[model samples]
Target: MLKKLVLIGGGHSHALVLRLFGNKPLSGVRLALITPDIYTPYSGMLPGHIAGFYSYSQCDIDLQSLSNFAHAQLCLDHVIGLDLKNRKVLCANQPTVDFDILSINISSTPTKLSVPGAVEYTIAAKPVAQFLEHWYQLQENAVRNPQKALNIAIVGGGDVELALSILAGVRKLEIYLFQSSKELMPSHHQSVRRIMRDILSNQDVKLHLGERVCEVVKLINKGLTIKCESGLMVTCDQVFWVTHASAGSWLKAAGIGTDDQGFILVNDNLQSVTHPHIFAAGDIAKMINYQLPKAGVFAVHKGNPLYENLRSMILGESLKPYKPQTAYFSLIVTGDGRVLANRAILPLPSHQLWWCWKDCIDRNFMAQSPHQ
Candidate 1:
């Protein structure tokens, strides 16, 4: 009997897996990819895209054509839940998909709806499609009214500096960045944080550190109001929620092993702790032994190991355990063609040469897909 392999979400890891499987096929195994979008954006180039450096087609991967190349059934639907006992994958718009083995690569999203009026008034950064739609519309509005003053608020301390710089390019724009913690990027070294802080200050972007947002209100004058737990209020033309990472509640509800934050708990082999037949990768998974940053670089690095282990299991071979690197190089764009290079083990200085290096890396990764 032929076994079925189902891949959920065309994230960076899954995209590489599909490309590899296309080159080497396993006999008596059926493969299928269920994703919400036909073209998935590469997260690495997202900031550049927002900065107007890359076009939509330049940063997006053509998943439809990639799936066709891999000879996998492409089911474009939103997954709602999973039927683990019966080995069925439940979706929002299609019938239950049966699978002998399943791999989940769906990335995470910000904690939306946690604050009042957030869902209605603020924009969540994940589901890149939705955010892009609003961003493109805002750009159009800015173009139409070149002299209008805009107040933009970003409610997160993530690497949104590039996004802030892009907003600052607008004439008569006031940009505010709100962070709950006293410092930004608590994970990085103090020197790195200082560099970012100085850049934002020089750009005239207001910093609201240590302020936890409690509510977002829609004003009657076609604007928005943000209220912080510290009793501070600010009005802005638009609010973008780039808050902490959060996974789907359905994972915990369905009895899958998940961390406190709802990310799937997996072993070193990237197999679910509770379900060995199921694997997870990318931002949606948390390793039991090593805590990995939910970044695109780690996700991309796990691709080869995940592919090898998945192929090993399918061939009745022993699975290989892999450990993620403790230290990695991080290049962050400054939204004006400059980049900041940081190595957790040894922090590097910020320079424009790093931006050229990052562009080459991103373009090479995107060039892997022949259809892209």
Candidate 2:
């Protein structure tokens, strides 16, 4: 009897899994992929793309080609829910896909848009495809009305701030960053934070520290007013929410074991806690034994182990545990022709050479696809 293996979301881990499966096909196992888009953008090159250093085709993987190479049926649809009891995957537009084994590698979106008018006013810097639409429009507006000064307000103190700052510089727009915390990038080392602060400062971007947004009010003139808890209000033409990552609500609704934030709870082998037949990786998964940041590099690294375990499960073989490295090297593009290199709590100097290194690494990863 043949078993169906369904992979959801064309994320980095799933992309790698598809490539690996294509190279080493398994007999009697049919594969299918469910995703919303035919092109999956590489997070590493996103800033470069925004800065006009890379084109859209250069930064995104051709999922259609990759799926064809893997000999898997590509179902382009947005997943709405899962029929866990029936071992079926539900979609927004397509019919339910049945699978003996399933894996989810979907990305997360900002869910803290609880404030009034926030959802209607702010653009979440996730579901990258959607954001790119607004981004392109913003660029056009900037070019069309160069004299009118475009003001952009981004909420979040994470690595996103750095990339947005680069965009602000490239577009020559007035940018403001609002962070609830007093300091930026709490996960990074003091040195890295200091460097980021210095870089953002050099970019002439305004910073609003320790100011928690209370409400987002749309103005009659189609502008936005960001009111903070501290009674501070700032008016801007656009607001970008780049805050915390939240999993899809369908995970919780499907009765899957998830973290408090609704991210799937997975073991060392990347198998779902409640259902061994189901596996999860990438930002949507929360490792129960290890707390990992929702970073794409980690998801990319999980590809190998996840593929092995999935193949082993299909073959009725033993599964292997995947222990993430205690530390991984991080390269942050400085928006200019420079990059910042760091590892865990250690920070290195920023230089243009680092940018070259990062560009090479990102290109190599993209080149792994069947046809670039």
Candidate 3:
């Protein structure tokens, strides 16, 4: 009998695994993919999409097509919960699935930081589908109501916050970036930080640093008012929350050995610490040896190792460890064909040609059909 391999979430890592495993058949292994959407958006190109640099069709990976090529069954349903003890995966609409091996690659969600109205008023940036939909609606509204001043507040300090800055260029909106940390892009070098700050300044984007949001209140006539710990209040039409990315709630309920933040804990082999039959990759998997950033590049890089490990586990062979790179290139577009490149140093000046280079890279990445 063929071993059943069920993959939950069509995230970058799992998508690569699907493609690799499908292309070179994993001996006697059957594949199944469960995800909420058929198309998975590439995060690296999202800023470009928001900046009008790329179309939606250019950034999305058609999971259906990939699955068809992989000969994998695609289940378009949300995995609400899991019964780890029973070795069954629970879903919102479809029947539970039994598997000989399992892998999780679901992306994270924004942290519900207990700030009073954030849950009700602020929009999370992690759920790509919902955020993309909201972005389109915001753009439509902006075009329809050109006279109204669009005051938007981005609550976070990370690469996503930088991406949001690029998005501001396309909109006639007054943007404010709120960061509880003293420095933006805390993980990046000072030079890169200065460059980003200069970019935001040039764009007329306000930065509220070292201030924590105490409460978020929705006003009746006005929009949303965010009260900070410093006794300052900011009123905005829309709030974008891009904070710490938390793992899927289903993983926690499923008794996975996850961190307090809900990210699944995995060994170097990408096997779950708690469940030997299970594996994890992408943002959902936390490396025990090294702390890797939850970037798409890391996930994409994990594809080969995960594929090998899965095959090894099935073939009763020893698993291999996955080592992450210490540094990788970071290219950020400024919406108007200008870009900032950072790897070892701060943001280096990148002009339209750099943007074109970045565009080519992203397009090439998206063009690689996992199915083929």
Candidate 4:
């Protein structure tokens, strides 16, 4: 009997695994993929897509086509639960699948905060598909009401929030970026953070730093109003929340060893501590040996390592450790065909040429995928 290899989610890591498995098939292994969407969106190209630099087709990885090439079964459904004891994965619209080995590359979802009305009114920017749809509607509304001044609030302190702001620059919309921290891009170095702040300042984007959002309430005349902990109420046409990326609720319920934030705890081999037969990658896996930022780049890099480990497990070979580099280059698009490259402390100015370079890189990644 062929050993069943089940992969949950069509994320970047899993996509690479499929490609690798396609090129180098493992004996007696039957591959399967479960995901809600056929096409997985690339986060790296999302900013460019939002900024009108690339089309939707240019950034999506087609899972159905990739699965065909890899000789894997594609289950187009959402994984609602996992039966770890039985080594079975429960789907929303499909029958449960039993697996000999399992891997997960599902991305994180925006965590619900203590703030009131945030869950009901604010739009989350993690589930890229839903966010993209909402953003498109907002763009359409703005185009129809070109004369009216629009007020948009992006609640986050990460690079994603900045990217959204840059993308929203297509319209003459009045954008406000609210960060609870004293500075933006809190994870970045001071110099890089300063440069980002300067970029936002130059763009005339309003910044409300050091003010935590306590609640969000929809006003009859003023769309959505966010009440800050500092006793300030901010009214905006729409609210975009890019804060807090948490793992799928199913992971916790499945009794997987997870952190407080719900990210699955995985060893260097990317296998769950409690369930060695089960593997995890992308934003869902927390590196046990090395701590790394939840960047798409890391997820992309994990593809090869995961592929090797999965093959090793099938062949009774020893697994290899996935050591992440301390620092990686970060390119920030400022929404005007300009990008900033942050290698270390200070970010180097990357003009149109850099944007073009980034565009080429993203396009190539999408093109290499079988789905594309």
On residues 286-343, what C-alpha lDDT tens digit does candidate 4 reach at each position? 9888888888999999999999999999988999999887777888887787777888
**Which candidate do you rate higher for lDDT, 1 or 3?**
1
Each model's lDDT = 0.87, 0.88, 0.83, 0.84
Residue range 1-372, candidate 3, lDDT tens digits: 788889999998888887776688765877899999999998878887787767888889889988887888999999998888788889999899988999999888888668888888888987889888888888888889988778888888675444454455346778878889989889888998888788777778888989888898988986989899999899998888888888877788889899999899999899999998899999889988888988888998998899898888888899999988988888876767667788887467757877777788878877777533
The residue pairs in collision within model 4 are: none
TM-score of 2: 0.97
Worst 10 residues of 4 by lDDT: 160-169
Which residue pairs clash within candidate 2?
A: none
lDDT per residue, candidate 1, 165-207, as tens digits?
Answer: 4653455778889999999878788888888888788778899
The C-alpha TM-scores of every prediction are 0.97, 0.97, 0.95, 0.96
Model 4: runs farther than 4 Å from truth? Answer: 160-169
Poorest lDDT segment (10 consecutive residues) of candidate 2 = 161-170
Of 1 and 2, the candidate ahead on lDDT is 2
Q: How many clashes show up per model?
A: 0, 0, 0, 0
Residue-level lDDT of model 2, residues 166-283, one tens digit each, is 4644465778898899988878888998988988887777889899998999999999999999999999999988888898889899999998889999999999999999999999
